[model samples]
Target: IKRLLVEVQHVKNMKEKERKRKVEEKKDNRRWIETQREREKLEKIKGINTKKYRKTKKDIERKRKKHTKEEIEKTELERRWNKEKKSEIKKQSDRNK
Candidate 1:
């Protein structure tokens, strides 16, 4: 009878240990799921930030192209004015001679 009691107590202890291990496993699974959710959220935010960065880069490039076009136009006008002035000076000198 005493041996039977010892065996029964041993079985109970084994079941209790199994139950504790299962509980710890469940807690670990919950923590893993939470971390995965956080990682996904951060990835989504990063995607949005990259899109905004690309848009700003395109805007800056467009502005730079417009500025270069304006500079070209101004230089063209100055060159034409200089040519007209030179021709007028040549004509006046020929008349004086």
Candidate 2:
């Protein structure tokens, strides 16, 4: 039946969304852990380290944090885009009916 097929597809979509949510959460947790580790490294660089070494470490940490933040932003944007596309498709289908 068309209705049954629609229900099955909806279930699949829900499952996929749940999976994506879990993956996004994992990425966020990873970003948090990396940020914490970077901060800890920066703190540790405060004592008995050469000024040059400290500067280099700080720069690397800054770049890494920036990279991770950008990646998270990108993922969120893609998710939003996909959500909008699905909504648009649903609207079009309704209009067709």
Task: Please count the clashing residue pairs in each candidate, in the order shown.
Answer: 0, 0
For every candidate in turn, the CA RMSD to the true structure comes to 11.8, 31.3
Look at candidate 2 and tell me the lDDT of residue 24.
Answer: 100
Residue lDDT tens for model 1, 1-97: 9999999999999999999999999999999999988876786667555565668768889999999999999999999999999999999999999
Candidate 2 lands at a TM-score of: 0.47
Each candidate's lDDT (Cα)?
Answer: 0.90, 0.92
lDDT of 2: 0.92
Worst 10 residues of 2 by lDDT: 43-52
Model 1's number of clashes is 0
For model 2 the local lDDT of residue 68 reads: 100
Q: What's model 2's lDDT at 71?
A: 100
Which runs of model 2 end up more than 4 angstroms from their true locations? 47-97
Which candidate tops lDDT?
2
Give TM per candidate.
0.48, 0.47
